[model samples]
Target chain A: MATTAVAAPSARVKAKQSKRFKIWIGFLFLLLIAGGYFIVERLVQGLPVTNLSSITPWGAWIAFYIFFVGLSAGSFLLSTLIYVFGMMEYERIGRMALFTAIVCMIVALTFVLMDLGRPERMLNAIIYWNVTSPLAWEVHFYLVYIALLTTELYIAMREDLVRLAGTASLKGKVAKWLTFKNSTITESTKKRDHKWMKILGTIGIPLAILGVHGGTGTIFAVVQARPSWNTGLFPVIFVVSAMVSGTALLLAMYIIKKKATKQKIDHGMVVSLAKMMVGFLFIDLGLQFYEYLVGVYGLEHHHLEGLGTMMGSAYSWSFWGVQMFLGAAIPIFLVFNKKTGTNVNALLTAAILIVIGIIGVRFNIVVPAQIVPLFEGLPAGDYFPTFNEWMVSVGIAAMGLLIYTFGEQLLPIEEIQSSEKTEG
Target chain B: MLSNMLGSKNMTEKDWNNLLDTALPDVEKEMDASPFDTKLSFNMADDARKVINENLNIKDFHKKYHSKLLKEFGEEVGQDFASGADEPAQETDGVKWGMVIDLRKCVGCDTCTVSCKAENRTPPGISYNVVLEQEIGDFPNVAKVNLPRPCMQCEKPSCVQVCPTRATYKLKNGIVTIDNDRCIGCRYCIVACPYGARSFDFGESYEDEMPGYNDVTSPEYGIERGERKPGKTPIGTVRKCNFCLHRLERGEEPACVETCVGDARFFGDLNDPNSTVSKLSKSPRAFRLKSDLGNGPNVIYLK
Candidate 1:
């Protein structure tokens, strides 16, 4: 009777855990089905089904596309800080950063595909190779950046994969398949993997800054017609904001995963990461302030109109409420306030809010400029994403989360040993 | 009898000839008074009579006397004569098509807008051209300005510069054309156009209100896009004015030019210095929209 009582509790606990997991899977599956139906309908009916018109050709999908691109670039840059710059303190989330970057890139590209009126002709952008186009350049850069990220991630994981290869679990099987049959866990192989990671990470710095994220910013910056976007400082702001979002995402993911798995949270690392994220945010704000100040002072009609739309229009709440308040102010406070700075939960909230805030920032960047008519006498565009748009976005985001979860389960994403044990 | 015959509705051929012979001066005497050859003039007169009777064409007569007429007149006049005679084979080399809109003449009737829509067969929300009407200054001292806007066909078109696919391009004739089959409907061009000239085809049709609206598509850029079905090449692509190239191919003016009530719009090859647009473009009152931006718009507006 005593043994039955002891075993029954454990069985109940297992059932509870599985039920939680099943519910999560069910939620994602439901999102996918709902989103999939709309996506198919969009393809069948074309862009007419959306609220988008000639006046507002780009809407929610484009906003989400750039948003995910920012996230991917941000996270990849964070990983580079760890591997290339020998920022060993932030090494715990290095692999997670790389993995998050890849997942975000997938989601971003999916958003772009959905935005395209003729999604079938997407490959034509590559096949026809318009060298003058910043967008074409971005497409090529994305592909190369993704390849580089995958390689860097693999090298980072070699030691862990080699260690896990001997087990009889799913991760073990994946690790065995990924590594060569004759791969060994020797001191020399470890040194070699670390050396390769450093080299790739060093190469990745320019690729991420000048090619990936900075290039994404250049796509908007090179638009000479939109005077607000036509500036040299825009790309620099993109890189800085990417650093902020990337750090916050990794911090949130790390803390949340630890809590979920009932593992020990690294409070010191979490605090330090939150500080770094705020530091980047401050720089981004400074640059943006100057950008807006110069644009306003220029007294250019179109530039003023664009800024007015972003700051004073109906959607200004996204800029003032979400971007400034939740994304910037609260997160900065959470990181700086003596009471909340050290609290893991508070820091986690700050990190999540910052991530969401960056999304608002991206929307502010893409939507406002488009809403301002290119000509003065023309009617201004009014756009809010439709129900179908929100649903598809949720589906795409859920897909990215599901990918991240599966990747973590099948890969050695978590820290295998305590910091002290590793040091020892 | 002469007054009666002159007033009569019916007159015999010999009687009409006799009346013309009596009324007209002697042709041989007039020809001999000036110019080179009497026989050439006599032959021309004979050919003119045949031409009047529909037995010989005027073009054939010109061809028969081309060299003789060139010789009778020297280099400058000779060149002018030859060009006037060979008007059908007008030289299109170095042609830069341009438009000159006389704003003072425009009545803001939206005739160009309606005609452009009919000619282009553009779908809902896709206007290839528009006329912006606004009253400037305060209420006490207000003046309404009507600006008919078309594709500027800029020398450095921002749309062409930003297009991820090079589906939109400028022809040597200064008309900017979109290869709808190649366009992926990204609408980047629409966003990049400074003049708000480009539009995206969101697949909306006039079929809801106008039956058989999609039966035939406009032959834009001289390509006969047959039907206006959903998911068709242009139905899901970016679109803009191509100066009615199909009409230009048949030696007809753009629909906007043909149908303008005030005759405010003029279209011609600007490369020809003697062309009407080229002359108007050089006028002191002529200016381009946002000229300081240096896009070098082919569409000129006369203030």
Candidate 2:
């Protein structure tokens, strides 16, 4: 893939490319600085800087935490389609998915750290280990899942690393340091790598579904105090929506990267991935329909109040405008409509919208349930992320993107060869 | 004529005694007609007179008759009678402290709320107790209900169940205490508390309004956290009412109970069936908030 995209360019074109890259990095670095300033302020000032109250103990940080966790789990599950299930068509994005999952997990954990009032005492969650608490369980699972992701990414890159190790470029230098001196790509070595990838992918599938994302959902579901989150189906919705966001994110990244690098856009993969993303969105919408339908029909006071807050209250724009219309409906239409579905740019837009929609879904999930007063006669919670919270979040997200860009620059993330293209 | 005779400065002691004996009901005759225990009744009557006269202390009076009453009425009734006069026993062993608030008597004064703040020295945005006031019904028929809520000290505390660090836990005495030192400040416990009784100490202070506001911290759970500061144990951790364990340790009622303007709140050992809280909790009017959730709240409310 690099050879095909790298056909000798003129010096002017190379300079333009390098200048554009510098500008992009510069832009991201400035965001990092701005965000970093707020993060430090938040750290010094504590959670007081955020709009969080005892009534709404969790706000944007937790919302973003779950959002990124979903993204990570979604991307890892997508990679499983190639490594575990032998979906050759998606193999081009396979390594990208794994790397994205790792990056998203880092971002997710960072959000959690920001949310903690005593960030220094975070280790107590591990040291004490309350098995009953779903949050505690999630903490353990996240660590284990991250380790598994790192290991799997290494194995997936073993062949690529060996190939790049022979070159003198920066990627080759990093590859030389990563690979063992005796590392070779024989037929058996290839078979062994493939086997390990399958084994790890199989293990990761359950881990992601049951332990990581599902466990993240369990953190909320077991909160019987919140009627909106106490259902068994909540975790399932989490995993499904993760798939939607994960696929959308990868589709967006793939298209955006291809355009940026001036490489041939894998139009077929782009269309197929968009369809897969929308399919997950439809399932997510259906599950959410029943989730709300059952909650409404139950007529339980807190549950109904929670639903009312999400659907009709001041925050309903997030539900109707962002989550439903832009996130789900538009994306579904774009993927299914023949003309737009085939248009690469249109599909890209749908993918980006879906990713943004999932953010709305996550915020809706976390905030509304808390905004409903735990008991009648108590003050109803009012919360919106403060400027500090938004800035800190932007900083953290930019930091994740920066890490991804650096990783792409240094590692053999891009495929060396284009495999057989499956028709979309 | 009797007043004139008594006013005579030289009224002799024997004459005064004779006058008292004649004026009062015949004690011997009364005791003889009452029951078979005339001797014991006569002794009690004499002691009662001495008590009224302030010649003997009440503790001695009860102590003197304790054995006789036990012999006469058997152990159970005897114990009840003895305890009625004796000071309440300071038996903390196996004690489950509980509260029963009479909502009708609350008056919506917010005194409990204020006194709790002063007593606990909780920072801004952190109130261990609050009165939830609402008007029920509509228009002319409306009735205001004042629900003074403190930590329920739930038997099955959802906060305890969800605390990943076991920092929040139910003590043997039924009060749920948070170990701020061990807490990760995750706020999961706050989310899990059904009563909305928990607060994350966001390190906000009234220092602007009252200088030296952070000079001394409330000794919550008997842990003497000296001063409030950023990143302190409680400053960044979750906190809730421990039923004022420090007060309980010193044999005082919770601040809310002591300062309630309406005299609505009763706090005592729920394990002691004879305690005021236990009796109040057994009343037909007594109920707990969100009892359907089955947390077995130690805080009972009288409607």
Candidate 3:
């Protein structure tokens, strides 16, 4: 798919691209409608429409919530590497990362709303804050983090938004609406924008790590009843895994979007980013290894039971098949292999696989510990998300992609075109 | 009431005492057995009865008892008395209700579980109480231990700690209560509870088996919710044992405690050192389930 897209003639691609976007959007709309039906059915009937029970109160929705939150945190932190730390080596993808972070956060919160049994009352989490609850803290942190991300993205694109304000294009209308009429690409304004981006990015670093993603990990880790998640290392592991997923997603997105538009792929940046992603994965795996080893060695019954449920029980296939082989080992081999390591298509494949693998990681984290009943002699939870859950997830994901696609077109999400850039 | 309405309000004080004594012969007998003056006990009990009925000021009773209690119990009780005994009444009056279950005496007939179901009127998938039957050892050496489980109502309740909204909270009486109206049905409390005490109300009903099952709710927490309906406050929210709070408000024991056939369960105010529950809780034989986790479960069990 990557080769064909890259090999396509520019004139033929341009003719078909507009129609393709329409068809893609139409397909996404159908999925959204279908999923919306189940969403409404769930709301009206309450939680009974799904297979969720008291035994496993959280299901696929929770897993996806954490998955997207991890993605958002990871992507935001990656943008910090470019804007804050001045790693201009990978500057081309900086705006994309920030935009992806925003979209991913929207998707993550949608998943949370879907999972809520009383979604309308969700604001109560804010109104009546139980300061002890990690979940409550996460709600507040997510809001502030999203606000910071939007500000950073806006500052990063301010120069482009100003430059495009005079054009007759659709993007021009949006650029005019977004920027002040007097906005200009002067050296002073450019300097001001850069400074603000740096400041926001610097603030965002801790917000993404400790407040967003690490706090998400704390939601699970603080549950003393689930000993496997109770370790201090759990939040650290979550931060590392976020880096892994974020880098992989951005690398894949950059490659796909470039190939679709028949633009030049920055081979040096792709290769280096892929290497960094795998590096983060290795660290993540090492931390998880120690987490498991310590948990097993301590011989706590529930911890052991949780590990057993994840690795050896009926749920083990997801652990070994999706997360380890597809998510880790194969991606590592593809990135490290001599012939394929430098290949753009292989790296893209590796990136996509890692994203899927992290989804498996999320499911493994949420479901296994719950499967082991809280007490001995009690019935263990048996959970598989119903068709309604899958539909809701698919719909929410399509909504995120649609937003990203339109965002790319309407805003200067890409490095502003060279033709347009020369004028500015 | 009809006689009073007919303007025949000329009952003498002696006549009223005769009527009260006749109406509650059992209470009269119990109060008479105590060594302290029975007249003072009756007077205090009479004032407390009026207080429960909301007919008299509770502060008036406290003021009346301040000097009398000091005079009767002597200087030993002075410390507690002098510390503003005239203060307005407390919400449960320093009572931390707890339970002690003797495993040796429990026959595991599941009477407590059944009574809890009947009293709470929980749906098919939800039970406020359950007796877990676990077999110890292996083969011929096996011994069965029936662990009757209910909400621990912990001093530091894990559910209360993790609740996103302060919907679920530990009342002053030590019963952890869920204000269903405020609950968002996030189920974080269910996930956090170490004892697995909480359940999501799925709006399921025994209506198919017993007609009108959804007609009326059990007035849990003394709030009279009329019907069991889909997507109601509790239907989408979480539910758990509030130690039969409605029954407690009526000055009656929880249905489970009342129905324990083995007499294994003992319920009283743990804050009162003289209460049976407090004494049993201190016993070397008494141990709480997973006490080391530091939730400080109020439910104690004796081997």
Candidate 4:
């Protein structure tokens, strides 16, 4: 009688939860449909639809591209902290991190495709790799990194998938298809999968740091024409910032997903991860401070102009308002404050803000330097993403979310309760 | 159209030959006015056709005509023959094409910019060359200067260094060129170029302003790209001054160099010490823009 009384409320909650989930999916689909129209329009018209000119060849799409790449690199490295370094405290978030990395990479590459003047010929970058080109090497590296991520994620999910293959949910159906026919969740199979996960994650650390994100930074740093980006510290800052954004994204995702499903918030993990994310941010800001100091102290004209544009011109709001205040100061305060630091809700807001702040950072990185002309007398570039560009970015980002959402529903991205106690 | 097609389709080889015979002028009569031997001209023509068709080796043809041409043409062919004796196909070798612009003589008229547009048929927003005008000093003491900016065709081009597909490369003659067909239109080259010499062809045409603007595209790099249309090789790719490569091939100066109203532009082989550009490059007054970056710009400026 007591069990029936308990089951009744639980059933109602489950129904309510499923309905909410459907609405979320429907909302995303509507956005996708809306964004799809503009995506098609931009593709048909080509790059002229955007405000990008020869002077400012890259704009919002590139900023977002690098932003997503940073997220992917940061999250993958965070996953490595668990899988490779044996940090069991963060084990629950490991698969989700790997999955987010893959999703973010897809979004980043899609942005890159959208930015290309001739999107159809993108394979030419890969087919004819100029060995000296960091962009070419990055193209190859991103593919390898994606492949490595997928393999690691698959191995990480192996035991769960094998266990789920006999069940009747959508995830079970996917598990049946994804797993080997006679796959078993034996102790030996578990050990092998764990070993493989460790091996792949170990390889991924350097690949993510140097080949993926650092290489992306090098794409800007190697441009001697843009003195603001030409410093050696540029790539290092990129790796560090990736850590800041990555940890924040995972923290926010954990909280949001748990809230949506009405699960118990992992307060300890959230607080600890928030601290680590802030620590990384402090380091990122220090490096960035030094980077700007050296650039200003050098007193190079183009470099100064770039910094002026980023910090003192019309675009300065993005640098100070969004990147520093919202992205850094507020988050740092929230994470450190006595009352708010341990609060799950406060930490969630801080995580989301940092992610948004990193977007501002990315825009500051890509745009301001180009605003200062390459030559003294050449007309300086004026750029803003057209409505079409914004819509296309919206569409691409919506598409990534759809993939992640469906992937979560159909795969074992979330931690299985049975394995958690045993593993811990 | 069908009738025209059928008429040509039905014409036999013998009929075509007969028609060709009637259409032709009398070769002997035409040659009668010339002082040179008609037999020699006819023999040379046939052999030249053979050389063109690869039926006879050009070296052997040159050997056969060497003495006769020298005997007939005298001092002209003697000098030409002596100069052209070695490396007949390699005249451009050791000839690093460079341009020396005398800024003092420039009036900022933009004639070179105009002529460049007309010659290259570059669409709107795509100028291979532009004259940058600047005002120096504070308001009352200001002095105006006109700098005609063209592609530097650098020895170590940053564009070539950063291009992902190796689609753009420096040629043997020192002109940096683009394989537009291979360019993915990533525009990385534009960002990497310190001089801002490159422009992206946004597939724009001047159809609204002028009719038939898209009817012809300049045979840039001597490749006969048919028209300036969307989805074409150069339409969605990075483009820059190639020193008018096709014009250079035809033994003509770049349109900008030829049409400079101030007579400020000099185009010549920099490797030849006697060339005017070579001498100007050696002048203390001559300097390259952004020389500290080590691009080794072939475009020299004499102030």
User: Would you give me the overall lDDT of model 2?
Assistant: 0.91
- Which tens-of-lDDT digit does each residue in A1-424 have in candidate 2? 3445555666887698889899999999999999999999999888889999999999999999999999999999999999999998999899999999999999999999999888888899999999899998999999999999999999998888998899999989999999975699899988999999999999999999999999999999999899999999999999999999999999999999878866678778788888788888889989999999999999999999999999999999999999999998898898899899899999999999999999999999999999999878899999999999999999999999999999999997877654212110
lDDT by residue (A235-274, candidate 1, tens digit) is 8988888888888888999998766644457678888888
In terms of docking quality, model 1 is: medium
lDDT of each: 0.86, 0.91, 0.90, 0.91
Model 4 bad stretches (over 4 Å): A1-9, A418-424, B1-93
Error of 2 at A240 (Å): 0.3
Off by over 4 Å in 2: A1-7, A419-424, B1-93
Q: How high is the lDDT of residue A153 in model 2?
A: 94
TM-score of model number 1: 0.85
The DockQ scores of all candidates, in the order shown, are 0.49, 0.60, 0.56, 0.54
Highest-scoring model, TM-score: 3
Q: What digit string (tens of lDDT, one per residue) describes model 4 on residues A148-228?
A: 999999999888898899999888999999996689888888889889998999899999999999999999999999999
**Model 4, residue B30: what's the lDDT?**
84
lDDT of 3 by residue, A383-405 (tens): 99898889888889988998998
Give the TM-score of chain A in candidate 2: 0.97
Q: Candidate 3 or 4, higher TM-score?
A: 3
